[model samples]
Target: MTDPISIVSTAMAEDTLRINTIGNNVSNVSSVGFKAQTLSSKGDVHSDLINNSDGRLLRTNRKLDLALQGTGFFVVDNNGQQLLSRNGSFSVNESGQLVTSNGKFLVQGRSGPINVGIDSFSIDSKGVIWVGDREVDRLLIKQPNDSMLLATAGNYSSASSREVKDGYVVYQGALESSNVDVAGEMVQLMAAQKHFSLMQRYFLLYDGLMKNGINQIGKSK
Candidate 1:
């Protein structure tokens, strides 16, 4: 009785969540170095718990650009805490330290933030920092676990601590491209729309059947 309705309603709710995730991916299609997020449903019990996966790699030609080829994250310091990100859109600050577009200091070496004193800098393949041809600090690149979940505040939660790489590469004058595929997103959009429509039809049919049953009982009485 109520089971079917509950199933349909739960399915509809999950469909809505899927639509929202798809919408976000579509909106960020042209975002520089943006990673496309893929959503997955949890459990066979029709629950709405969804998870996302980061996919694909892209290349950008900005002199301040950076891209991580393998599984690693660039360490960023927001206030006094550390944040991790794959986005390599970077710039040199007045102090000559490499920073993100948002002005957060990029971590270098296994040590704390490296302070730069000049106006010119470059990152080599080994993530070493070059301040006008002089090696100052190595970029603090970390290889987080694959199952680690990256969250807000530029932080990540994983079973193991992040791996520091003294030899990870960072290319200046290039950016990593976004991972979203337009064709795949469009196909997902169509499927979600169809599922939504089918659920709505089922809801309507359930309503009509209940109404007819009530009307017949009243006539018999």
Candidate 2:
């Protein structure tokens, strides 16, 4: 059996981690395509936590501003490394390449970076990119088989087992809002702090009781 101090100590540690995650969510409340993380447990034992959820789509009415309407991610080229993101807010660079908010180039058709020379561009519901009267390239949108494979890396998420999704729909002139619920995260933050404090008090009380009992035994001897 576990000691009272041990139980409370473990609980306090878990509570601290949970509180930090909640704080992160609160901080990113206004960030586009931000997914709220969650801590999960088994019975009375707290274990792994993960953040991966669909965010609500918000209209920005800007042409380059894009959002996924279904299951898919807009691929980006950060330097030479490929990254995935749900944040479709994109802009053209000086070289005319489509880039994400973080300055990563947007991966387009033929698995290459896109460079539409003109500022005038429009994306249809099918993820096709059109400039003037010609279709330059189609946007590279992919989907992962599992949500667990998606993990936060810098300003975006990395995925495994990714496949180009042809059945996905892209929404032009919009962006996906962060899924973090500000009120809910605030409530969770308060509750976690309360639990941590209560656990600390319990641990202190247990330690005091043990100390008193030890001193009494020593005096009797």
Candidate 3:
């Protein structure tokens, strides 16, 4: 028979992982464009992270902020590596190039890096950027064939294959709120904690049984 102690220990480890994941979700509940992650069991021991991208839109009413209303992501050049994100909070850098709020990654446009040049610009529903009367560029919005295949880090996701998605409407002066359900997470966390406690009790019970059996053998000798 398989050792009960080993089985209990494995269950405890899995519980710890689940609690940590729930904690992370709760912490990022207010992060802009953040997606909630859920752990799906693969077989008996392994699990996979599935990100939920169904977040609600928040109106910021700031011209520089942007938001998507449908299935698509804004493309950003992260040091030559293109990354996709729903985070539309952007600002112009020192060189007049549009970048993320952190002033790190450059926001990509149809031509290349967008340079607003300190001029007031407006983005239409179709992702077109207009500076005064002339149209400068359009934002790069793409949707992957399978969003689950992309690796997610915070509000950004990256994949090798990119396909331009024109089905989405871009809403300027808004952002996407995180999709984390705090109440649901709290319920799951409580269940995991209870399971962990039961597993710990089983472990202690097995240890005591082993000790008792060894003591009986010593008495016989």
Question: Number of backbone collisions per candidate, in order?
Answer: 7, 0, 0
lDDT at position 206, candidate 2: 88
Q: With candidate 3 superimposed using the best TM-score fit, by how many Å does residue 146's alpha carbon deviate from the native? A: 4.8
| Model 1 ranges off by over 4 Å | 44-62, 104-108, 146-161, 164-168
TM-scores, one per candidate = 0.81, 0.85, 0.89
Worst lDDT 10-window in candidate 1: 45-54
Q: lDDT per model, in order? A: 0.67, 0.74, 0.82
Best by TM-score: 3
lDDT of 2: 0.74
Angstrom error of the Cα, residue 83, model 2: value is: 1.6
Ranking by lDDT: 3, 2, 1
Clashing pairs in 2: none
For candidate 1, lDDT tens digit of each residue in 161-191? 4766554456666655556787998999899
TM-score of 1: 0.81
Candidate 2 stretches greater than 4 Å from native: 41-53, 104-110, 146-154, 164-167
lDDT of 2 by residue, 1-221 (tens): 76777778778888987987788777878888776778776767653344556678898999889887666677777666666677788888788888876564655544488888765888888887888878888888766554432345324544463656576678899988888888888888889999998888888888999999999999999
